[model samples]
Target chain A: MHRIALQTLLFHRAKVAAALAGVAFATALMIIQIGLYEGLRSRASVLVNRLGGDLWIMAAGTSMVDDSELLATGAELPARAHPCVTSVRPAIVAWVPYRTPAGARHTLQLVGSDLRTAGPTHAYVPWSFAEGLPQDLLAQDRVAIDDGDLSRLGLAPPLVGSTLEIAERRVEVRGVTTGIRNVSLIPMVFADVETARTLAGAAPDGATYWLVDLADGSCGPSVARAIERDPRLDVMTREELASVTEEHVVTESGAGAALAFVALLGLVVGTVIVGQTLLSLVREHHKELGMLRAVGASRSELAQFVAWLSAFVAAMGGALGVILALLVQSGLGGRSVELHYGPGAILTGLAAVLVMCTVAGAASLASVLRLDVVKVLQ
Target chain B: MTDERGASANVLEARGVVFTHGTPPLETRVLHGVDLDIAPGELTVLMGPSGSGKTTLISILAGLLRPTRGRVVLGGSEISAMDDAEVTAVRRRTLGFVFQAFHLFPALTATDNVAEVLALSGTPIRVAREKARALLTRFGLEARLDHRPGELSAGQRQRVAIARAIVTSPRLVIADEPTVALDGPTAASVMELLREYVSAGTSVVLVTHDVRLVRASDRVVALEDGRVAYDGRGLAANPHGAPSGHDIHPPTPRSSEPVAGPEGA
Candidate 1:
């Protein structure tokens, strides 16, 4: 039966090729759409995700990293007093006016962290620097910008040492990072807490959020609850904060619903195309199928043959589809809407393609099982 | 009534076999009450005009159709009473078939086409191919073993189909117009091959209108208006095997014309 399945599919090269191509196109579409959605979610929570913390304390009702009121003075006191707390770092995140070198005005998100309190790799600091070091931002009036934002910031490549103004205060670009993007298209600028406070007209002790690290034996949920006692502050574990931020952004932007619809459309269209092709192939080979039945092949045996054929198509087409999606992702590098086709996305796409092919194969198999052997013999 | 060989010796028996198309008022009867017995080691040719129900009878006998009434017993199993799967199993174990269309798998080589049946019956593919190779070689197809159906001539394709039919060494071989599409020489060759299988204790039921082939058969059962019009050992006998009245002779040399009505039901 396996031999028959393989030989018959190979014999109908044109039809098989068309099915494969349809499956590949559909799989790629699904992967790419899912990758884009993941990318969007990741970017929406990029700041909170990259900052090394087990828990976060912020002003009450703060929904995301960028939209938060300044925490009341000494909001970190409750978290620091807890025995499970190792350290609490005050960080400043605020939107500030930017004046490009071309005299064009724009708004940039300013993130302020004290690098002296933690190391460059495992702190509330962004990594993947294209040039310069995290310590450079610690210098007074120095800031870091993502290389991806250079064009929109009106700054060219080799951005290190380039000067720009934030809130009418001149700040030198001391470090450039890669892959740090905001879905809102707002350029993110990193600086020390003092510079960010002075530029954003915030008081020296004001902080938008307090990032908390826990001791090895501590549970984040317990510590978060312990700190949430203060009525003016809300606390969340890092994972919870990331999830909430992602959900908030997706809901606010409406991109999730739109992308899901497109992905669903791809699935339906792919299923229809592959299903119709297999049905037509079955019709074309009706005589052969009838002969098999007339010669003593049971319904299950015929179904197994169809299943094997569908499996082959799904496996091969899914693999090709993933590769194509990766190629597309690579091509879109540094673009505004980056795509991330990780292992999860690839597996999901393959599963969808397999289901599509199975549905198609079963439709054709029904026709085969209902074959009229006597009529065919005549 | 049993012949000299007795009913116990029969390889197949069709008792009051009847078949109808459609249902209720829309029904059209194709076979009334077909009673027949086929003994092993002889070639039986089913003859009839168009709409005479020869095809329907052969279909029922092959277990490809369920008779509306009565039962068909083949090789000790009542196939007409069996479910489709059970009848399929019986066909696999005891029956072979050669159709006018040859129905060979177009993608497979001649050897693989013949090997598929043995494989279907649980023989290892390697062993099945070996057996198929031997059978086709015996049938003078060794040179064309690797050729697909499209690459083979009509005579060669028929020979391949024949090889595929008998590779499993079934007890009965049913064929419908097996040589109707062949020339005199090709048809004769095919007949000779089937006769050889018959001599080896495989009963053959052939549905054909070819006069030369009919005259060569050991028995002829002629159908008319969905009933057996004549059943005899030789065409020279009268209808119903009585030695007296009008005799059934072979169709004239222009045998392309059917023996009775137009060809097929």
Candidate 2:
């Protein structure tokens, strides 16, 4: 039976190739759409994921990391007084319009923090720099722009020492960072706390988040709960914030739903194409199947043969789709939307292909079972 | 027919078989109370025109279709009383069939076609292929063993089909117009092979329209309208002996003397 299945597929090379092509196209489409969705979710929560804070204190009603409601300057005073709290640093997040040398204006998110603070919360900022030292932002009116944002900022490579106007204050680009892209394509500029405060024209006490660090052996969840007792603030661990941000972006925004619909369409298209092809193959060989029955081949054995054929097509198509997706990702080279093919995405694609193939095989098997051996022989 | 001890020597027997087609208002009776027997080591030819129930009777005897009434016994087992799976198992183990179309799997080579039967019967693939190759070589298909059905001539394809049918060495071989699709020489060659199997103690029931097969057959059963018109031995003895309508009586032997003819003409 195995030999028969393989021979049947090999003998009808043209038909097999067409079926494989259909499956491959569908798999590629599904992978790309899901990959884009994952990429978007990952980027949407990039800052929350990268920030090394045991807990974040935000203004009440703040749902995502990008929600820019300012907390009072003394909001961290209560969290700092807790026995588990080790230190508290004020981090300011503000989106401000910057004017390039040519007078082209673009809105860029500004992250303000004191880089000299030797703690986990400040560690991620220095390590993220791709071209220059994080200490360079300490220079007067100095800031760093992400490598992906050079064009958006109307600046080119060799961007160090380039001057831009933000909130009517001239700031020097001192460093470049990579992998800091956001789904909104908004450029990010990292600046010192004082420079950001002066540029945004905010009072010295105004801040967006209070980055909290816990003492050794201190439980983060307990401390977060203790701090949440204050009614005017919302306290969350870094992981919780990342999770909430991802959920908020994926569900509240329509982009995720659109991508999910495309992926589902791909699954349906693949199943139909492969099922129709296999059904046609079975019909063409109806007489042969009848002869097999007359020669004592059981129905289960015939079904097994069809399943083997379906598996072969699916395996080939799956491999091809993965390769095609990787090639497309590489070709894009982070120019537009990012393509993230993480392990979760790959496994989901594989499982979808498996289900599609199994359904198609079962559909054709039903047709085979209904064939009348005596009538076909006649 | 029975021996002196009143014991049946036949390998297959049909008693009071009736077949009908279609539903009540459109019902058509094709076979009406037909009875026949095929003895061991003899070639029996079933002769009839189109729609004369020759194919219908063959299907019932082979267990491919159930008769509307009556029983068919093969090798002392009442096949008509068996369920479909049981009938299929019996056919797989005891009966071999060769059709007029020579239905060889188009994707398989000649050797594989023969080997398929052995494989289906649980023979290991390597051993099955070896046996298939040896059998095809005996049939003068050694050079064509690797050729697919589309690459083979009509006679070669028929030979392949014959080899496949006999690969498992069944007790009975049923052939329906096995030579109808071949030329004169090829047809004669195919018949010669069937005769060889008959001589080896295998019962052969051949359905055909060719008059030339009459001389080679040990018994001839002719049907006109759903019933036997003639049942006898030797074309010369039963020339123009077929009645115009149905005959229910058992045909009697004309004489004990054997008829003479060319053995392989």
Clashing pairs in 1: none
* Cα error, candidate 2, residue A99 (Å): 1.7
**Least accurate 10 contiguous residues by lDDT in model 2 chain A:** A118-127
Tens-digit lDDT track of model 2 for A184-287:
67888887776777776667866788888888535777776766777878988888888888877877878888888989898889889888888877777777
lDDT per residue as tens, model 1, A1-378? 879878888888898888888899889999999998899898888788777688889988888887877777878887788888888887888899999888999999888876778574446565788888877888789998988777889999768877898899998888888877787888989888877777777778778888888886357777777778888889887788888889888766688888888888888888888898788877776777677777778878877777877887888788888888989988988788878778889888998998899888889889888888888778
Point to the candidate with the largest DockQ. 1
Listed per prediction, chain B TM-scores read: 0.86, 0.87
lDDT for residue A10 in candidate 2, whole number 0-100: 83
Query: TM-score, each model?
Result: 0.91, 0.91
Per-residue lDDT, model 1, residue A102, is 89
